[model samples]
Target chain A: MPTKKGTASGGTRRTPATGSRAANQRADAQRNRAKILAGTVTAISRNPDASVADIAAEAGVGRVTLYGHFQNRAELIEAALMDSLERGEDVLSEVPLDGEAAAAFQRLVASSWVLVDQSRALLAAAQKELPAARIRELHENAEARMRGLLLRGQREGAFRVDLPVSWLLTTTHVVMNGASEEVRIGRLDPEDAPRFIDAILLPAFTQKRDR
Target chain B: MPTKKGTASGGTRRTPATGSRAANQRADAQRNRAKILAGTVTAISRNPDASVADIAAEAGVGRVTLYGHFQNRAELIEAALMDSLERGEDVLSEVPLDGEAAAAFQRLVASSWVLVDQSRALLAAAQKELPAARIRELHENAEARMRGLLLRGQREGAFRVDLPVSWLLTTTHVVMNGASEEVRIGRLDPEDAPRFIDAILLPAFTQKRDR
Candidate 1:
């Protein structure tokens, strides 16, 4: 059969070209959003009262471009917070959840301190500026994962089942966050965080098996 | 003997009168200072940004009187912080520290939570508006007492001795403060604070004795 005429061939080629161009644009937008988010974390960490204009400048993006990616200041902060939490979750997901529950819990605590120490300033600013409900929303997934691990521990008799998992998870968050604050203020040595966490948190979760 | 009786009797009465008057004045001054400090705590708790005038109004004292007690706003805030810490220390002192380490620790945590919960706003404001050093200074006494108890527990084999007692005490403070923040933000139930503290903290300090 004879090939289609010039106009039909041109239509097929042009369609693929247009689709690739659109995909490239979408990827570029995502990169810019990531850059803006990273810049926001830096700016807010340096100065909790940093303005949108300051953050945009820090990102090396124009105000209009920043606004295009994030509608307003609150939205930008929320995005930055979500980005930080996602990073923490990425770190947390690496710890094996199926092993000896107490050992897994220790690994979780150690990995968590790495993220907590890194995000101290951002966490402080968010806790100060955001509402409790919004902060809790960002933490919901982490809490659920932690609760699941604790429940597994309890079922295996490695952890106490007397206390609610919710309280245990909340206590874990509170202690980790508090330790981060201590490190920030120079009250606790950063290197000692993991040991402190293991020593303090393990006993709280683990039950006396012989008993 | 009767010749000098009149003059000597008058002198004796005048000396006692003067001494009593000075003692009365000093006591009154202390009472007024206490009132102003209490008022400052209330005002700052109600609004972290409260002004000197607002505190004076809260105390039902004139600005002049308030200033007479505390020279300036920073001084007033410092005084208020010290006063709050003193109140907490007073409560802490009531917990018998010489008893079984675990039971005493629980009592300490319980009594401390009462003060922590009551002074949440004041503590938050102090942490925010003051330098870390100043806040740490106010906490020095409490830290000392906590360390003492931890040492006693370690010696008695009631608590883990492998970890530094200082770190353990710091973790205790961190967890308590975090729980207070949770209660303040309505994330954790206030009534559950004692149980949460026991469940989370007791194990952190208690040594794993043979059950």
Candidate 2:
């Protein structure tokens, strides 16, 4: 016999007591998408130039299932990259940037270190595979956000305005990239790496104040 | 009939009485060696992970000839990496560091920009493939050299002593790596990247005279 109007075959399947089944389907789709992206991250971490088949195999899914989600290797790689970036943005949004620019800078560096250490391989692959134009776009957006903070500090007389905002943004990216490389290569312990970042970057970004 | 002292040929058989023939052979060998190195540079510049077969194909030389000269891929790659490092060491050696510390810092940045820009791909590959111990050995030597200059500057009271010598080395490496990436992706002109390096690095390494 058929099931009830919203219930499924399972005796305990929570169905649309009020369209909850539709919500459950949506959650399942989101979970599947997350799984595919996670697999892509794993595959590309192993080999930056990994092909779509490699990603599919890692996900334990067929080529058609992979293609149904991502059209090609570039798309899959782009999605993986953007997913990491989006996660970074989310993390940064939660970080408080109040008080002295130096304090804010340290917090930012620490948070970034955590994110970079977690996704080191995927980040390296993105750098390798992403096109120049795409990188410029992403970098510019990040710079703008960072510059806004630096500008605020400058207006508050907490940062030196003699240096160009762009230079600060560029330099921060440089240090962060280096720290990430150190983490990836095991040159710096993931925990100790943040201390290095704090030591080097805080001094570079901080304005001198009378002690 | 025997020609000269050793062969059954009628004419002089083109054997020089002087050392010209041996000198000519030496010159030819040098020319072939240079060509092979140039080919290796090109191959590594394009693909740091390129195989010995790939280098041979790019160099337009037979596999036998390639192996006859280098013996194996590791030897050839090491030679290539060493050649690049020697060029950098030469640049470091020639820069006049006796003047103002900041001026000397600028010179270091300028020189490194040129070397790093040319061999970014090779550097990336070396980092990926070479044993970490060897890389650390070379890095330590470079650091010792930089440390001497930094110590000299600090003694002269023209530089900050708050940052460790290792931090300075890390900064320089980060700046070089950042500039190399910018050059590789065509975001910054090769000529213009040195200026970017100078702008970011000189200030970090220098005592803020204005402040």
Candidate 3:
């Protein structure tokens, strides 16, 4: 995460004052773009069909400034999705995954559930606007992180070896999203989600008695 | 599973020959309606957006005859879904549940998965034309059947009791639907699904070591 300014504008600067002004303008543009993306995430999370004007108002910027950063609604939603995933990656990468594989997996679930709950609506919005394959491509890093952990858990004998690791991974996600729906329909309490997730998953991944 | 003919036309009989002719006509109407419903299932399963003409051709009936049974597409899809669920109920009620819980549960999954795989697309089509609550209402028998098995399994200590039975049932569906997608993507073999489902669910429902 280093910021590298474009060199296209760098070559035209001459006086020190002009260069300093250009740097300040670049910083302003960068901040506006970040605000618009962040605002898009919040607006869409609250309402998937949120209008562009709502996003601009949420970001406290003009509609022109919003369009200046993103060419259209799809571009804005995609960038918002990317922003949310990057934030998720930052959080998921820091969870301590060093204990027993089961414990580590639950911890991962506990941390990731909140992120998934927040981003799932936005993800659905993105699906309506983008190709399904592109959506899957954007999700590669997060999927790999979770898939790697499931593989490790299975190999260490902490997870069931009778089922394929891919199946395990797929069901794990399904369980989380199921909880999201449960909460949506008022069948489950949101505050109790992490514990509910762990309760279902920890037992689910353990060895089968028949084996 | 007994057939109840309408009493509206029951009292309109006159002479013996006329009564016989009326009964034959009733039987013919019943047969044609059954064919249309069966044809709708096949047509929708093959293509959810299948038209009235497609369904009529599949059922080998004329459009007028098809309309004679169903007032419109929504009514037809609803009838088709009911037909499927009733067929499923017939098969499921015969699955022996007198054995150990885990074995019985697997037996249930193996039998129901085929019905689900065949009817899911048709269900999706029903969902589009029908209210969601109505759709859920239509699925009550299937859900109740599965829920009863899970409850018995948990009560007998053959299935994990750490999670709520409702959560267990919801995730059971998610896993089945997940497998469908996996098969659709060509990642898993279609013939291997039952074994795959049993492998996932048996391990998933076993008690955890910590508990």
Candidate 4:
């Protein structure tokens, strides 16, 4: 109890009302942000041109409150899109990596495919709102994670080394995004997405080539 | 000369002044439409949000004249995109398909890549303007040509048959589209795009896989 009462952390501090009330407000703000993000995804899913007012209504929050969390439509859309990706990152972080490179790639893609499908509308909204450079900047962390796995696969001689790793990464995105368009347009069944991705990507990555 | 006079053909009609005037006007209209479509492609290439006024100015046509040809902005963009695609179809139609399937795929991609690169901005414009189904409808002829080639590849056992031909077609699109993005962002060199596309897609199409 004595060691926990140090000046560093707010919960352990002496000012009861000040620290606790501030903490409570911060928690409330986080909860509202989460709600707004979820609502934005749903709103955009229903209508890609959903307004900020529409999102606020869907979130059951006032316009002022939504603005407090996000300054403008572009900011709000970017935040919502990033929030979904970060949530996917949590699942990606937990995927077991100690295995055959090909098997591990499959496991990672399986976890990711559903997230990609879920966030597609928001992703489209983000693309409309953000610059291409900004979008690429946001994808850096996700790209790095995949790059590491791909590098390991290449190192193990499990994946083709003739092509650049960057191009391979691009193909993965193309497949996932193309699959989204396929599912969106009813060209591809949603349930087949994960298997379809693995089927195309795994062989493509592991192929032996003369040219 | 008397035998050349016919009711069906315009040039052979007896009303000389009226017929020639209408014929000249039609040629002028065709030239204007061609100029406008080419200008639209260039305008969208410079700015995806190029306005009708901007496009008209680029084509050196009066706004009223531009409107006379295209009903609206959507119609203008669709026509421009379709025009470029039809131009590519000319090159695609000439690709000698009488050879080995893999080699023909390469030749077709080589012919198609630059056209795609050139028209990508207009495609983005079209995506923003038109519904997905409408865009697909416009792509029917292009898709048919590709389908025919890919079907030949699968039938000849030169490309993989395990995956559905439709999914294989999707993979080709994914690869080409992905390469464009790569080139757009300066991630892949423009000079290398054709080869890069060939490398990834040929293997993706031809790879024999366990899974």
RMSD of each: 9.7, 8.3, 6.5, 6.4
Model 3 lDDT tens row, B47-96: 87899999999998999999998999999999999888989899988999
Clashing pairs in 4: none
Q: What is the TM-score of each candidate against the true structure?
A: 0.72, 0.65, 0.71, 0.83
Write the candidate numbers in order of decreasing lDDT: 4, 3, 1, 2
Task: Tell me each candidate's i-RMS in Å.
Answer: 1.7, 3.4, 2.5, 1.6
The reply for model 1, stretches above 4 Å from the true place, is A1-33, A44-57, A61-76, A91-96, A186-191, A209-211, B1-40, B43-78, B93-95, B185-192, B209-211
- How big is the positional error of residue A153 in model 3, measured in Å on the Cα after superposition? 2.9
Better of 1 and 3 by DockQ: 1
Candidate 4 chain A vs. true chain A: TM-score? 0.85
lDDT of 4 by residue, B77-112 (tens): 988878877788887888887789899888878877
lDDT of each: 0.79, 0.70, 0.80, 0.83
TM-score of chain A of 2: 0.78
lDDT of 4: 0.83
Q: What digit string (tens of lDDT, one per residue) describes model 3 on residues A33-152? A: 888887887888788778899999988899999999988888998898888888889999999888788888888888889888788778767866665567777878878988888889
User: Among these predicted structures, which one has the highest lDDT?
Assistant: 4
Which is better, 1 or 4, measured by DockQ?
Answer: 4
Query: Which pairs of residues have clashing backbones in candidate 3?
Result: none
Could you give candidate 4's per-residue lDDT for residues A153-172 as a string of tens digits?
99999999878899989998
- List candidate 2 segments past 4 Å from native: A1-32, A43-57, A67-74, A97-102, A136-141, A206-211, B1-29, B36-81, B96-107, B117-144, B147-165, B180-211
